[model samples]
Target: MALQGPEELGEPVEESEDLDDQDASSISPAEEITLPPGPGGDEETEEALLLPWDRFSAWLHCICVVGFDLELGQAVEVRQKYPPGTKTSICYLSFPDSNSGCLGDTQFCFRFRQGSNRKTSLGCFLETTDRDAPPCLKQGHYYGYVYFRQVRDKSLKRGYFQKSLVLISQLPYVTFFHSLLKIMAPEYFEKQEPCLEAACNDIDRWPTPHPGRILTLPIMGVVLKVRIPTSYDKPGTSQLVQSAQRLTPLIVVSSPPPPPPPPRCFYPVFFHLQMLWELVLLGEALVVMAPSPAESSDTVLALVSCIAPLRYCSDFRPYFTIHDSEFKEYTTRTQAPPSVILGVTNPFFAKTLQHWPHIIRIGDMKQAGEMAKQMKVKKLKNLKTLDSKPGVYTAYKPYLNKDEEIIKQLQKGVQQKRPSAAQNAILRRYFLELTQSFIIPLERYVASLMPLQKSISPWKSPPQLRPFIQQDFMKTLEKAGPQLTSRLKGDWIGLYRHFLKSPNFDGWFRNRRKEMTQKLEALHLEALCEEDLQKRIQKHTEVETVDLVLKLKDKLTQAEREKLPVHPGTLEKLRAHIEGVILTLPEDLQGILHKPTTL
Candidate 1:
């Protein structure tokens, strides 16, 4: 609700004034009219009016223009939404750094993923703000894809129109969002608010983005085909829909197009892939310096995606500027860099972030074909960005030896004039295999923590899981690590020890523990269902029977709340059995039990 400019110049003025004229009535200059929720009478009509953010698949939330107004300086010029009362304020997202010095540049673009420093649930986050205003989705973060454009006009006081088209969304589908912005930004500069509304309507038609299913998304007369990844997917396996397959033609196409191939973002840093892989897996701080924002974001995203199947638990900003709030904290020499990956286009960062351990400086990847034709596999030099060539620059050595076979394969592909997509597939498989090999020992160790199924009992609480001992796991790893299976080997034990201290490892372990605990609960419920309830009740003393009934009721309620899977009619049968046992007791005792329990 903090609309950052004067009422006359506020982003909502144009849309509101236009509506007021059409209706022949007065309306507030700053507030948009909220469309009422549709009734359930007509499903197709309701679906047509549904806002993109209101949909279950809510890939987009809001669209706005952030620019330099002659009078207001950096301000949100105009904002447009379908239903218009989304409640969430994107004013803070209009500009990332209050003092981004590079704003004067004629043409540039960058992206930012914004969220709270620490994770919190919906209730906790809502408590700190106006309770009525909630985000469109159940998520803690949102992404902003910005396209900045400036041109000389020589007719106005500043003699130029400078603005950025900002697309805000809850989804982290980086490649898709950026590609959509590419199609909309230039056209919006020529036309205006109508274009934004058209784009939003197109987005509303997209189906729910369930993981692993192919999605056909149409926007601005182009249709994109993609598949969002699930936890089980390997790196580069999920296509982010970087390219549009076709225009929406009158003739129907028979077969759906294939999903867009994963981007070859790693081609620029091909020689130092293994070293970068080690840095990413250990969650080290890295800075990616590129010729422009597009390259910077792509490279940073690719680096983060290196260890897929294992989520990158640490913070990462695909496009970070010197104007960012954390600029001072990240650049100060007194402390080491935090575990993060930042993409930057400014030359100023080369000096400010000089103390950082790892840096990858890359040129324009648009000339990837030319680079492939000219270059070959070569040794890398120490990372020096200020006056050095584009290459990976890091002093820290890697634990595993570089796999010469993979290198040879990639180099051969490059020499053969093979497409970037083929090179990407080959590299993706290598990393996927590497991650699996590294994780096998950890998987084998955690599987040993489960209590034996036969040890479960209907008359007692479920057995606790065995605790994970690092020393015991290391001893196991010594005998059965990647050394037995991997062609490239160095200090597998050392690598595991290093990774154990990272955020990714902690997150993975917690998830595994939660899953195992749930399985144990389900097994306990199964055991109770299979027991002869009447015989078991008769065997126990009166006091013991009462205690068992109360505990069973509590456990059943919890299992239902958690939606744990159990045998059919398991809960209903137990409840009926409890009722029969209580009725068979003395009349006075039955009354006493009935006062506190329900069957």
Candidate 2:
């Protein structure tokens, strides 16, 4: 992954800013394990770096061993290893309690929202959980990734050995970590702790992950090729790695990568594709029932990613079981289900979560070629008749009509024997376009809030955003709504109204408002800089001049403090103008301005 030696992992460095208070709360204390020095390490160096623990903690918060306990008659975390830190309770997370009782081996992913008890700590370079609403900048919701594996083991009492090697990273790199664990977990089970140390050492050598670039990550001798997503990326912009091995060793497909996993989940529910997209976008509480943990997690993850670019503010768990800590909290019939998407393999959930509005019951996925012929949406009772077949079960109607064009396109691809990757790309692109169409009207209306540049004045405070009126915005949407670009048309206005009530809308609106406000401030600064500094100073009295300078200083300070989106060149030019005005002033006035500090 890199030319750097083992010493790089041990080198003392400050903790990354990305690992904020909320993330640290999920990192519980594990028994600290001491290890021998690296190739050329000394006692002081080992102490400084924390050795393999530091290496492991760099990419993973901790390594957990969760499996069924025969003696306890329940699933329990057998052992866990965490870096040296103040201990905190991980009770907030509802870890899966039962193993996916499949044959040889199966892998899947799960996500959980850590409790609201925010705690602060140093170290751990976890990415912000939701890119749209960074926990460090916004609320204290941290999401954890559980990469689970279950192997059939006759030696064990349950006839299977199952455990999850969890990564407490805020990053939603579902596919990447699954591949890493596929390689490491088997070795971990075979060789135990030493294997973990070796894998961590390899991870420590990986190059820093950056968007729009292909990253080559190595773990336990397997190499992974992945491309991180940039803000400008559209769906189908990146292709999934063509891994040679069935057990993907090192493929990290972050951001809009379309292929194998998500498409596979959709194949069984292909007819309800558009409806599934709407459900995810509307933040509906969805329950996915599959035959195993592998399918359950994959399906849920796929559902969550359907409305990407527009973050799904609601929480989701890929492979949930009745034994999870939140099982009762979620299954309680009295209260309406929370805005969450849950995936479960256990048939018990079919009855337990029957009250949930939307339920997707999918059987084991057939090969893409085999599934091509049976792509049809079957209508069924929500829960009473779930046992009869595999299809979408819901009473809620979709806002938009089914896009017959997309259906035809997918069908055409299937008939042509197009590769599964191509079909996936088509689906991904459709979702991306649908989301764009949905957001376009909102974006246009928001853009109108900015006042004309001529009205901005250096003497006046930054202009306020014209308040957003829902009714006014709706009226304008008559000519320009989601239907402007969308092929499917229904109550486009209704979709927008429903979205306004969602957390995603609130988060998006706040972020956009803040950004616009910053631009307004920057514009004011630019207007001030355009004036002749000497002429402005000469017109005002000494006191007025001093006050003006102070105001300018304050504006500049605030912009810098907030890290406003102003051009550096403009800021520098403004600073130079302010300095010129100060130097030209009378000695007494200069002294007053100089008393504080230079610009």
Candidate 3:
């Protein structure tokens, strides 16, 4: 464990041979004491005695400073539980300057400082007749620091603190240690070899320190000895009582406080499961190690609660992906990316704790609903099929590139008595291609809208659509439906029948019958009108042709009709009619007859 600067300076130095008797006795350091070695062949180590005012974060100070048992002692012993490889700090907590009503920026504390001359820093001093009196004990609480060196030099040290600093609440170091080793040297655990030495060799060859690599063998032993009470009954005092009762034989028990209310944030047996949840949120297809019940323990239950959603993300589990070691090996037998190559935990896992936030977030029902909503979202309606769209107005614009000039000429020709055929033909071809192109996209646009509209129609109410869109679709049923109804009915009915047969499309297919009927009826009316116009044009042409043949029979003389030379009287009529009939007659006859005869 890394030491704080002050902690190193305060290491026990036997009375500096050059000091005065009173001063030297008061300054005994902590590390000089000897203790029995446990089975591990390692001497137990202890930390300097500390007070409530010791160097700790504000959160830690608040957790340590108040509400404790104080009858036989004036200070409460409290231990800090740190992550693996981090040392446990056993400090004596007490309320100092009790006269002060509220806690503020400059709270009281005392610390031992080294150097031949520096004085001890303490929040308060207690007067005692027998030197063991608790003058600072008040209102059922302790209010001073204990000098551990003096108590221990008298061979009266208690709890695990007599030898080593291990918090009762620290996590089991072995499981965490293996989890760390897996992150640092994954291939070692993946090997089929059952020999333990290979795993150790792999750990020895680890390239660098992993994020969770703090749990070393030595720390594992200390963590094993820690025995945290299963319950918390108060803010700061209950844990102290638990430790004191276990370590020292001298603790007196008052009635224990009722257990603290259960917090809603505990997520148990979910280390790897939570990790997989993170990948799910990231939308990654990465493989991970499967979660197992044995991976969890009480020590990290609070931490798991902090980092995982617990219930909100449960839906993501079915989609979570993972692979075993053999599979990973088989796949990587060819090639693997750099990220996959690194961070291998047990050949099967490229799982990492990187970028996981320090604090856990609890997800709400609304957030889950939003996720489901995204899943519910169908592709939007094809706006191309939407009526009154800008696309309709702009439809002919692309083909109108040279149309302005041509249109101007056609209008001029109309204003004049005659139009040029060359210019008219050019304009006609341009419009034909423009009409052709528009029909193709329009048909495609309508076809595309069909499936999209069907898919989204059911989800339309809450996520509302536009007025025309929301209303019943395609309401173009003729005033009187198709007079010849069977063909039109068959076409629309075919569409509805096809829709009904599809799985899961019943609701969308529900209104198709009425809509298709309306559209087909409208189309039938247009077809009937077109047919009527063509009949009128054909009838008018037939009447004109018969009239012209009758006129020819009355005026042409039989000789002209038979193509023989006409009589002078008929010739005179032909001459008089020549100018009017020039356009209608054969060019040769008109040219020869129209020539002036010698008068």
Any idea what lDDT model 2 has? Answer: 0.61
Q: TM-scores, in order shown?
A: 0.71, 0.76, 0.15
Looking at model 2, the pairs that clash are 224-250
* Ranking of all candidate structures by their lDDT, best first: 2, 1, 3
Better model by lDDT, 1 or 3?
1
lDDT of 1: 0.60
Candidate number that wins on lDDT, 2 or 3: 2
lDDT by residue for model 1 over 1-599, one digit each (tens)? 00010111112234334322322112212222233321112334434443323442245545667776667566656664311221123332333332233344322233333433221121221222211121112234455667777667678789776677776655555555556777888788888777876775676567644455567777787776756444434344434444444453211111111112323444556767888888989999998877666556667667766676566677776677765666788899998899989888777887777788888777645554544432333223444445555666667778888787876787677668688778767766787778778888898999999999999997678888999889999999878887766788798888999999998799779878877887888898878877777787787888877777677777766665454656778767767766877766778877886664332
Cα lDDT tens digits, model 2, 69-120, are 5673323242233222211222112234333345455555554444432221
lDDT of each: 0.60, 0.61, 0.23
In model 3, where do residues sit more than 4 Å from their true spots? 1-27, 31-262, 266-360, 363-599
Look at candidate 1 and tell me the lDDT of residue 500: 94
TM-score of candidate 1 to 2 decimals? 0.71
